[model samples]
Target: MQYFTICAMEDTDLSSDSDLDALINCTLLYAATKFKRKKRIWKSSYLRKRETHGEFRLTSEFSDDQFTNYFRMNRMQFEEVHNTIQNKIYHEGSRAHKEITTKEKLAVFLRYLASGNSYKSIGYSYRLGDRTVSKIVNEVSAAIWECLQQTFLPDPTEELWKQIAKEFEQRWQFPHCVGSIDGKHIVVKKPAKSGSSYFNYKHTCSIVLMATVDANYKFITVDIGSMGRFSDGNIFSSSILYKKIQNKTLKLPEPDMISGGEKELPYVFVGDEAFPLLENLMRPYPKRKVTANYENKVFNYRLSRARQTVECAFGILAGRFHVFRKPFEIKLASVDNVVKAACVLHNYLRMTSTATNVEDIADEELLSDQLTSIRYNNSRNSRNAFLVRENYTHYFNTTGAVQWQRDSILRGKY
Candidate 1:
């Protein structure tokens, strides 16, 4: 049998364990110590150093070059924002160290978010250590969240509620609707040795992000960090919405004609079956009739229209940042920060964008008409007749009361 030797072109006598160890050490040394030859000049310099020293010493020189190069690049970008971040970290608003600026650190963090890359990848791009990259990402994200919350989410005031109600009417054609409520599961890989707390009905570990969005797809309320094992209904029941409902402190806008001055009247919000049925909270009927009438159809239509904003809010966050589009692999504890940051950023962008009115999205009437047409068309075909028939029957049977309520409000009978 023939054996290969390190740097060997042919079989040799130097095939001992020490020889093999030396070869392995030399390979590691080369990878760690070699200068990243950016140009012919750099390559020549590195080659000259290698010739001057033995292989091991040459490797050490290259390692130092690599380390210094990485440190220098990282410091350049970090220095730009060092002071701003130091002030934030110190909370004294003092002049930051001239060495680095917070804006630079923030820019690096945003670059990570926009790219959805790993810390190591980000470090390589910024020429920093992975640990430093991780720290910057977390700190900058916290700062961004703080900045956004201060600017975007105000304390619940009557004026804010009134504005929200007006936006609802104008954007969704849903009168007196305070907000659209929904819950979404953000999938995550199951952690080792952890309990089954994160495992949901979807047979995967996840966390729930429940939100109340206004008609224009702006978040009015956000609750994160719910275990995925709980049902959406269960999560909602445990949320601040439930508390607000119980305490009756959520003093929303009174129902009033969109054409007239706000007459203090009762209005309702739309949710799905996951929420409890309440006079102030409207939900789609669990079932429909085969011969659904205009009222039943209208109830389902209006409910869907009001509920869509929450879906759209979730869609925008997930779509714009693909990081949450798939299962995450981090620790469960960090899920809340990710969700909160996403929500805060969503609101921040909405506030800054000129398209805040949501005129760019499809109108509710057009969407409703298309959906209804599809249902009617599908019901006529026997292939989908049973399901369609069930849907039709369910609406008339369960949604009649809601339709009447909406009509009564419209007619000033309530």
Candidate 2:
């Protein structure tokens, strides 16, 4: 009708039936094309009301235990983390479409992290666009790292290192032990055009997250985003942590004696069989197929105890932030930020939640830091490392020995 009205207003000649038919067909086609696309709308209404939903209710109406289950942290701890990153994540505007508040952004990001839900799924729950969900996660992750890294996961200081060593001695009974260092393969989808670099022995593509954690299950240092194909030992050896130790760049304290034991030893990080036994890094002695020596058994048992800190740390991370259980959506550049964010959050929770379960583990599987120095000569260092292990072994068996270590639990599985 409009096309005809325009023709009539211009007094255009349309006497021919064929021409009139052609004009009508063209107009109908144009109209169909114009209306075919869905109309754009503002304000996601009728999807879900986050205000009346868990985002608000979880804070006020729900119990702290329920809140912890959903966000992976109690309300108090969550509030502390939110407060630190709130300014950075705050969206300032007065657009017709409501802006996601800092709290909502954090809630969205934490929901994604705490549940490992797809962006679309989380978006549906929060009435957000999938892209918005992704953006919020990335943004919050960066903010968490930027705002909390120094206080929560800062580089080890001399005095802080001493304090950590003291805690280990008192808690885990490993004197001069500063932290436990270990690495786990974080599974990720194979990257584009890259062949075999990320492939690992388990027939999966992954990146390694290496961390050093103190006795109280707090991460002291972290190194992440290493290629997974490399063996754990090789990865550690080539790491900046290893390089610093080799070059003597870490401000490791001078050699000192244990409080209740003899033989002066340097501060060390305990690791599993994947790491070499260094003067400042202790590893268990190799298991024997035949009858094992009594001293080696006792030494391995004690080292295993110190090493459990890293194991439990990883377990708690996987248990709480379940994203670690499955293969991560393959993202290289942003993976470090995400992993680092999770680790920092772990520290935050450990620092704030006094009665929290530090021993939590992921069901069935998904198991998966501190420093040691180096010697220039491989042979000499090997000799020195053996002597150091022997020193700790003798110390544990005699003066430093605890009553519980005498139990039958000293038996090594391997």
Candidate 3:
């Protein structure tokens, strides 16, 4: 379609300077009709019937399994998310068009995250424009984070830390372990002129998602959106969580005795080799060191079991949401909030879900090395750090020893 702006002008010849000036100065006719460039058919037949086939239709008409398959959550879970954020995402309608319902906006947002499809493709399925779909994604993602973070993913309290430690001991037999910390690379399109800032060693543009997870695969605290070019240790060291822990401002519980141990030991977080060894953080012994002795192998095995909580969390996240399975194809500005919203939603679904296995959003769908093996250059730490680790090592090989740990380590499981 073509467009023309029509106006009334004095009768004049193009050859004359006066006529040219008159043409340039002529006022646009107030009553003149201007043609606008628009699609000849604004809504196609398929588009008009989108309500019968789009996510709305699927979410409403599909059976429980089908519903979960499409949206990555059951209807009850989806409604919980909708009810929490509907008001925030809601907009008043004007004469031009009826406001998009919060439910529809959420459907659009979920389709984008659940499938990692392009906005244009999602818009096509929803009978909306690509720009509108993009807007909905950003708006709904913001609402998901702001409305849900406090309730679903609150910062850990001192009491909560103690509970986490107890659970870690009970569940994984790793006493005094508070939480598991790790980082995952969330790939994205490189921002314009960002240089190598977001370029990772894997040769992809990405951002880091650093999370501390509790025993039940729930995120206790999370920090994301750092450039992927940064190492895991650098991201951990620079994060506010690290700062708080180092300054003793996070109010971690005081040292306490384990079931069979006489000495009080500081509660600690479990991480892979990518993190520093500190009095309050335990990482695996180096491969060479672990091979040298039985005690080192036992400690590494115990810590690896405890640290897999975050790995399982990331696995379920990438499996159910699927957005993290590839580079996020949304706007760069929206990537952080999108990831934040997913983390918040993961917490919510975990609490609400009773579903099991591959079809379940809460299942521990552990990914292979792809999501778990991002490592950094190892650096040694303090003498006190070594002492703290040795205390745990001694406990694990002796009183903290489980029947299967030694066998598992001898089988080269660590």
lDDT of 1 by residue, 1-414 (tens): 012224442333346777666666666666554444322242233333422442223323445435223222133333433443456643222232122235545545555544566767665555555676677666666665665676675556667777777788776666567888777777877878858987877677877777788876778888777777775466776888767865778876554543432233345666766666555566654455303454454556656767877776666665445466457666665556666766766675666554433322533223221111100001112333233323332443353234355564355321
lDDT of each: 0.56, 0.77, 0.82
Best by TM-score: 3
Per-prediction RMSD in angstroms?
14.6, 5.3, 4.5
Write down the TM-score of every candidate: 0.62, 0.84, 0.88
- Please identify which of the two predictions, 1 or 2, would achieve the higher lDDT against the true structure: 2
Per-residue CA lDDT of model 2 for 57-116, tens digit only, reads 455666777788888887777788888899998887555566678888888878777888
The local distance difference test score of model 2 is: 0.77
Which stretches in model 1 have alpha-carbon errors above 4 Å? 1-86, 89-100, 254-265, 289-291, 355-414
Give one clash count per candidate, in the order shown.
Answer: 22, 4, 0
Q: Kindly provide the TM-score of model 1 when superposed on the true structure, using C-alpha atoms.
A: 0.62
Which pairs clash in model 3?
Answer: none
Total clashes, candidate 1? Answer: 22
